[model samples]
Target: MSVEATGETRSVVTAATIREILVERAGVDPDVFTGNELLSLAELQIDSLAVLELQAVLVERFGVEIPDESVTMTVGEIAAVANEDR
Candidate 1:
């Protein structure tokens, strides 16, 4: 296991990329993620398990760790977490 093999070589994590990961990997609606990035995942009825899966993808895909309180974080907040690590 190398970092490149784990897909952690990406230089950045953008909102669009996060949105794509949400839609493609986390089962979130494409349209849902676009509006009110301040709203928490719970507000959108996105379950904690889904968020955990999303967090996993963020690490495997971007090498960023989601906070333990991730389910309470908004989409923008989630992106910030990744960007912060970068």
Candidate 2:
């Protein structure tokens, strides 16, 4: 379901959305993610190629354009940014 379809009543921020994307794409163990935790690509073993894949997924899934400035963000930070954009 799309984020809106979740019927959560509260708005989902870009940071949260990005966090969800990471969780799904990285196969991150749920217990390890708080959606507000600092996420390190190196720690997660995510490579440059994987980052590109993530960019594609975020665009496709959320229809939000990710800018170059966003590349420096951690997973949680990205979601927060996304929330602001939406």
Candidate 3:
């Protein structure tokens, strides 16, 4: 979603947005992403199927390409990469 920054507006790809996509599209638990902790997908209990789904949603929503080697990346890291691509 678009967020208002100080005199400069930008699109923000937040962890909450990722969590919502996981919950709504991938059937992940809402409680699983309770904080802004930087944890890997495995640490967040995301499975292989969920990872693929997450990647698809990221591409569709942000038009950002996440490399396959990023399986160990945290949500925050992924968001940072996506934001950079914006």
Q: What are the per-residue Cα lDDT tens digits for candidate 3 across 1-86?
A: 43444455545888777778779999988887777367787888788788788889988876777767555888777777767845
Instruction: Candidate 1: give its CA RMSD in angstroms.
Output: 4.0
Residue-wise C-alpha lDDT for candidate 2, range 40-86, written one tens digit per residue: 55455555655666678867765655555554567666666555635
Model 3 scores a TM of 0.75
lDDT of 1 by residue, 1-86 (tens): 76668886656777677678778887887788666677888887788778888889888877788886877878778788888835
lDDT of each: 0.78, 0.59, 0.75
| Model 2: pairs clashing at backbone N, Cα or C within 3 Å | 13-83, 14-79, 14-80, 14-82, 14-83, 15-79, 15-80, 16-79
Backbone clash tally (model 2): 8
TM-score of each: 0.77, 0.52, 0.75
How does residue 49 of candidate 3 score in lDDT? Answer: 88
**Model 3 misplaced regions, further than 4 Å:** 1-10
Clashes of each: 0, 8, 0
TM-score of 2: 0.52
User: Better model by TM-score, 2 or 3?
Assistant: 3
